[model samples]
Target: MNLSQNLIHEIKSLIAKAKEGAIRSVDHHRTVMYWHIGERIFNEEQQGKNRADYGNYLIKYLSEQLQPEYGSAFSYRQLELMRQFYRTFPIANSLRSQLSWTHYRLLLRIDNEDKREYYIAETVKNNWSVRQMERQINSQLFERLLLSNDKESILAVARNEVIPTNPNEIIKDPLVLEFLGLKRESAYYEKDFEQAIITNLQDFLLELGNGFSFVARQKRIHLDGDEFFIDLIFYNRLLQCFVLFEIKTHKLTHEDLGQLQMYVNYYDRVEKVAHEKPTIGVLLCADKNDAVVKYSLPENNNSILASQYQLYLPTEEQLLKEIRREIEILNKNDE
Candidate 1:
């Protein structure tokens, strides 16, 4: 018996499809296996009256016995992580095969149930990678949201698919730049910092918060045979607007605000679609003068914001002072 050329081709295609399916099935099974392992470890730890000490001893003994045979996967750290995996997601049925164990590891660190749930929803909704998820968690996305809105509103936005409409809803005031690894006392130029941000663009985007998708760096614009370039361009799906950012190393100036306004105008008129909301322009600077910002921008300004970026994390005392100042200002306004 001889096979026809068409039959051979069809058989090859079927074999390829079968192989692909098998690979997918294997991955699915692996994920399930890890989840079950985590679940079993969790239950055993709970059964022990002294769960914490028991867990520690279990991991230590398990690693001593299993590491030689099973390799690094069965080590103390890995077993501890597996135990945490079960604790984080106690309900076995709730485990999602689409998400990797790494994703759950990050979620386990978040102690707040509502916050963890919000991240879970946002991660799945945005299709964020594990790195992105970790970045968001580290940046304290939940705390930032809490500061901006009431509990009801925050939970509503998280549970439902409702995207934030206002800039304040998502934007962090003192944007952290520790990821850039710049020294506080280092006399680096604005261009140097901006370039570093460009180099670490993916991390920068994650730091920028949710809904931001990078569009361009130093994006060129041409008008009347003259050319201008915007420092950074991004689209925020949650805000339904284009976000334009300008970097400044020195204290923010009126000129900087004016320049950002111009960029915002250009984006609104030339770049933004009719269905989209107004374009937002952010001036990322080392320091900002509140009076200068108030005087430069319009009273009802919502499209433009001046945010100070810190190379290093500020001390708790400094943060407390800032909070106190904000409270004072709010009190005065109420008066």
Candidate 2:
């Protein structure tokens, strides 16, 4: 706390700040530069559109011409990526400074416009690093959300343009727990799984999606003469409600739904304030029967839901197939 020590600490802090600022500046500049290169190459390719060999040799020739002076960053593969980046985000001004060239490189892999845009908006809003963005996309976070929602609402939430009001908006079905390092084939207790989630709380929150804050684990609640414990408690700011979760290591049943419903009622009556929304309860289990779920809850009930949990990441092909199937269903419903 001496004056000299204080000065040293202040100078060190300033130096760290400057270094971070410089790194960010460099990343932003690199991104903008790549965008310009992509723009130039795209224009050149358009001009050569009439030629048969135009598109085939454009990147290779460009790489040969530019790599010598510009270095490895202009390799044929990198050039193609740049072209893809430009194609994904045509307007240079639409690119975000918060994202780097690495981020866009991963995003360019996504061919679906809505999914790509959703990832971009979520990345910026969540301030996800390139690695985080990659993990989310690989885990099919958008598709998982789509499992519970239709296209319009899911896309709106992805864009961060609309705040979610209902519990369905924020809750994802079949929560991916690969980050927990749990084995799908092995038997595990709910307590062990909950502990794993607590250990990787950051990833859990990310998986939970926007506006969730962890409250407690095995949160204690007491009634007239008995004690009750909620497995996990989270508050969603967007819904302005408490999201109480009951962890089940087995198949979801009417009993499981009833327990969660009781928890939801307790939270709504005891924990929630007058102005706040009703508490939402989620029964996260190994499996769920849709018909059972429909019969377990009231006909118009939206407060309680049951979702399955997958210990491993679903393959891209699997997710795409599921997405296509769901879209077809939605289209049929529309008609």
Candidate 3:
């Protein structure tokens, strides 16, 4: 590039950054203003507790007085939301400046304090946009991560209280792929699925969890004149390991696990340096037999994992059922 072109690029970058900063400043102030409104409303309601339906009356009255002046932003519904926002995050200092009011609005939908805290930590840590956080919440990302992980440990990792040492800590089972836009009824080959992932690589990385970076596609390995191709590979900085993914368009079998395990071994032995952790292999299949997966790997196996993939998001009922089933399986194992 010529000097003029380089100068122009630098100027554009600077302007873009300045605009982004200005937008963030506006959002932060908006969030703070809403919090103060909520706090005032809550205090006023408390003082009028003897009146019947006082809280509702107060909010409704406030909405009436403020709406004409402030517009729909202070409507009854919005005022109620602001009231709940203050109740949810009682301490103003605890509010995250990186998150806008929309982010907190989405978080208010979650009733569980632990779950809400986990999402807050993740949103701030990952710097997720409002839409990205919404998708994660709708996909029940927290509940999905709990499938093979303990709640406390998962929260700890999200809060950065502890670093993830194992794949189960960060990698979710039954990965959601609704963002890929693949129809559930349509048949797709492994190559097609891999191609779709590549096309929506950014969303895929988000679903893959933290610290993931793309490495290769159809990465070839030759062993004793035999050529083999791994579907996709990623590096996770948090785990400090290479993650190998083998896409299976059908139900996972013992052979598939064996193949992924071999790729993981190859990566650990050939690709990884001494300071890095062991390579983790995952079988991304359309369906999976958990019993088969259990018997395929050793009891202490931590590196090799299998995750079923779905083209569509699961309903809340379906997610609850899956979680219950996983819990039952864990209980049976203990027994």
Cα lDDT of all candidates, in order?
0.80, 0.88, 0.92
Q: At residue 170, what lDDT does model 2 achieve?
A: 85
lDDT of 3 at 295: 95
Residues 214-329, candidate 3: write the lDDT tens digits: 99999999999999999999999999999999999998999999989899989998999999999999999888887899999999998998888978877888888988998898
- lDDT (tens digit, per residue) of candidate 2 on 1-335: 45798889999999999998899899999999888888888899999999978965999998999999989999999998888778779998898988889998888888888888888888888999888899898899888887668778887876777889878778887788889999988999999999999999999998888999999999888888889899999998899988888999898889888888888898887889998999999998999887899887899998998878888899878777877876887789799
**lDDT (tens digit, per residue) of candidate 1 on 42-141:** 6776788565598677668878998999899888888887777766777778876556667777787778888888888778766788877876776666
**Worst ten-residue run, lDDT, model 2?**
318-327
Instruction: Provide the TM-score for each candidate, comma-separated.
Output: 0.73, 0.90, 0.95
What's the residue-level lDDT of 191 in candidate 3? 90
Off by over 4 Å in 3: 1-3
* Candidate 1 lDDT score relative to the true structure: 0.80
Q: Which ranking of candidates, highest TM-score first?
A: 3, 2, 1
* TM-score of model 3 vs. true structure: 0.95
Worst 10 residues of 1 by lDDT: 142-151
Return the TM-score for candidate 2, rounded to 2 decimals: 0.90
* Pairwise lDDT winner, candidates 1 and 3: 3
In model 1, state the lDDT of residue 261: 92
Task: Report RMSD for candidate 1.
Answer: 5.6
